[model samples]
Target: MKTTTYNIDRINHLIQQYQLGKEEFLTLLSEGLKHPLTWEAVFKEEIQINHLKRIDKIFKKGLSYYLDPTAPVTSKESSIFFRKEKFGTNLNLASKKIVSQFEDLKISLSGLAKLSDINLERKLPVFHSHDNPVSVANTVRELLMPRFKKDPKKFLNALIDTFAEYNILVFEYVEHPSLKEKTNIDGFFLQPNVIVLRRNQDYFKREIFTLAHELGHYLLNQEEIESMDYDQMAFGKISKVEAWCNHFAFAFLAGNELLNLDKLPNLTARNDYNFNEIKTISDHTHLSFSAILTYLVKKDKVSGAIYAKMRRNQEEEIQNRKEEEKKKRELEKEMGKASTASLAKPIQSPLFVSTIQSAFFDGVINEFELCKTLNLKPNQLEKYLR
Candidate 1:
């Protein structure tokens, strides 16, 4: 076998980038390249070209990426705001890669917007730290058409579309194949105007809440990646900004009617609200059960102890449902009826899609460039174009 030499320092850097230990690196080399080499060669700072090729393949990076000493490092200038309780000081490599991908997508969308002559200077409503959360919510609500307030689905779609109109880019990040495990990042607001949402949440209501929360960050001009929970709002334990954002999202989604104490069921000593009442409110407002519970807690209708109990029950119910799903999938697999998991659907802003299509039609970008920008194959282009 003709073997070529590579820089040991670059090899070590690549291993670090992939978050691999020496043993794991050797295992990857043995498994991927089918060569079980000694640690002595690595200690001597020598690696075969074939091994380098295998390393490049495993990292999904080019050979030159490992070879070039001046290769640009991934930018970490942007600040990430995560919930300390969820992932304290343990930002995983997978999460960082996801953030990098988000930045790349934002750059592509911005370039396409500029090429299509779209107005990138559109103004978003501004809110100050001192502004009352309710007032800010009302201001945002006023910007939307009256129809959106009538339905939850319409409200969410309209909110996202409205943000896009104001030049705020919203993109959903689906976990990539390279990610070892899901990251706790529910959503993040990037500098200037970019919102990236993790598609791990099963409920659309949660996604809606995340969108609203990130929008609050945008309005306040604060950049943060966060895993927000309604429970964080209790006793003002969270930061002032996070608390404000939560309140803004709550008021925005729940609306002023929910704030009227007289409209809600009166909480008695026995806590006598029936399932019918819960269903009625849920149907009327289209809020999730968990969201309703949170609202009641926020409105002081429920005690913290009761709220915590309800939250626990809700989480248990969700876990049970997931277990049922897992069993069903297993049974399907055993019966040879299991379906292959579908490819991840990348969520793009409607405005971004339109701009890309416009650029393609106007000869500003070719088919290959269009497909690459959209993260689609040549054959998949028609599906998006149509």
Candidate 2:
């Protein structure tokens, strides 16, 4: 078999463009390829690709995580990400919306930042495509590199623990339980206070990023606006306040240090976002296979034309896999039992704290899972537990 080598400079450029690291870039690249797999796959048992494809529905109605405490005077525009996507009443309506909710964060970013003990020292690689939504979201992943632990569970536990500390409710995940839509994502919040998660979403790497993005909205007080979202089309057109919230998510997860665009060399064009490389990085960062590939295309590390083709390929693969699953489900359905799964750990009661020692002493699990399973993972669990 021929080996696919990556172009370091090109990979670096894409990493820089999307403020990604070698691991994050490779994970997404691999996911969208002929046989996408993240670096995490090496340690993880090979998982069948789950094709829970569906649009991300963000609600745009709740009012949380949007207040800027430090600012003495309230300002109307507390953000930098926006383009007038339409004219006429669209502009007027959007302007009115932005004006009304600029400095009204019910939640606090700095407070959450201070509360987070998950480690926030990763250097974010700079990406040139600051204007792109995908680029920005991927950049947020950079902020999380500093806390990278080989064990996926630990990373998630830390995130969830922090969310719980913040009074977020953790939800029991059931796959596609919602009649509204389906998703590959592990966790999502419904509105002012409803979080839906697929506890079955076991990919550690991508799950971390998803947790961060969704929580970012809460911390930045964009939860209400996101709740109002009726369609995915609201992504770029969301209020400036919402844009800032997303930027904060990207910045917090990816971090400013790692994302300096100056480091991106033209050579990153050769990162080769192939199946093997993706596996390498995903293994390192523990990101999800699907997210790893999505980030690569968004970063422009992979060609647009090629990315489109890969999307089609992924769809076909999903179709084939779904057919196989249908057969499995048909067979399994006869048993008339539900999937057997449990929380990583027994959730702490409404009481604010649980000892790390208690988890290990209980003999419920080993040392590693105990340390992380304090209920943290970032996205749905993060918000739910918060």
Candidate 3:
């Protein structure tokens, strides 16, 4: 077998770029290559073609990249890892990897768009933390809001479609259930207009809220990688930019109904926390009950104790629902029915889809490149091509 010798300098540069420690990279290589190869054997010695191919798969850059001696070190300034000191939350390895994955996709999309002569520039006004969130939300709501739908999925899709019309790219990612390290982050907005969402299969409403929150960041022209927690809006100390985004998301989702929130009588022991009114608003707005309650808490209509108790109950209910769902899935599997969750694909932005299609049709990228860029298999390309 003709062995391939990977440039040690290129391998070292990629490891550093990914922030992978030497031992950690070696362990990954060991698992991926399926051989207990020592550091010296990989860097100082020639590796088999199969091993080199596995290394390329792990790095995700083409095999040619690792073979090139002249490949320059990737600039940290272009990466979120080095550019942002804070991301509104601590990013774990999975979170960082997910972000890096999308960042690379964004770069690919930009190049494709340029080649295809498709404009991906954001068509929205930028605002500041000092801007009035409610006013800003009202203005943006008019432009982005879709006809309300009670179903969370329909509403989310509609919002995403509206976003595409405005040239705001929304990409969703799904983590397989078997993955050991899962991302804790909900969503993030990248500058020059890209928003990435984590698919919340259990609670589509959370994904809806995440989309709105990331949109808030986009409008501010500020890049933020964040985990969306409504409780933080009520209790945790947050930056003004974060607060502005939260309020913006609320007002954007609630629309004219926000005016009525101020009018609702404050929650008290005698009022039963105005359950009926809150439920009605949640149904009409498609915002989660907890989200509405959190806003009420911010308005001082709901006491912290009341908010905490309600949140606890809601969480318990969600947990019970999850348990029920698990049993139901097990039952379905036993009965030989396909599980819908496993079949679900991450939502793709129409703008992104069109860009890739154009790139392929224009001879900018080949069929294999299209499938790779779209994360589809060759057989699955036909559905997307249409």
Deviation in angstroms for 342 in model 2?
A: 8.9
Kindly give the number of clashing pairs for every candidate.
Answer: 1, 83, 0
Q: What tens-digit string does per-residue lDDT give for candidate 1 at 1-386?
A: 44554555666655654456788777766774445766775445455677677676555557776666564443344223221123312455456556656765666667776887876664866788799987888878777423545556555566667777777778886766575567766788776788888764456667777888888888898777667566765544677788788878777766755555336764454655444666666665546666677667766777777777767887898999989998998999999995786756756777677878888987889999889777888778888877
Compose the digit string of candidate 2's lDDT tens values, residues 6-93. Answer: 2223223223422345565455445545875454542222222131010001112221211122322222222211212222122222
Candidate with better lDDT, 2 vs 3: 3
The residue pairs found clashing in candidate 3 are: none
Query: Each model's TM-score?
Result: 0.76, 0.39, 0.87
Arranged by lDDT with the best first, the candidates are 3, 1, 2
Poorest 10 consecutive residues of model 3 by lDDT? 73-82
Between candidates 1 and 3, name the one with more favorable TM-score: 3
lDDT per residue for candidate 3 within 200-221, as digits (tens), equals 8878888898899999999998
Q: What range of 10 consecutive residues in model 2 has the weakest lDDT sum?
A: 51-60
Rank all candidate structures by their TM-score, best first, as comma-separated numbers.
3, 1, 2
The TM-score obtained by model 3 is 0.87
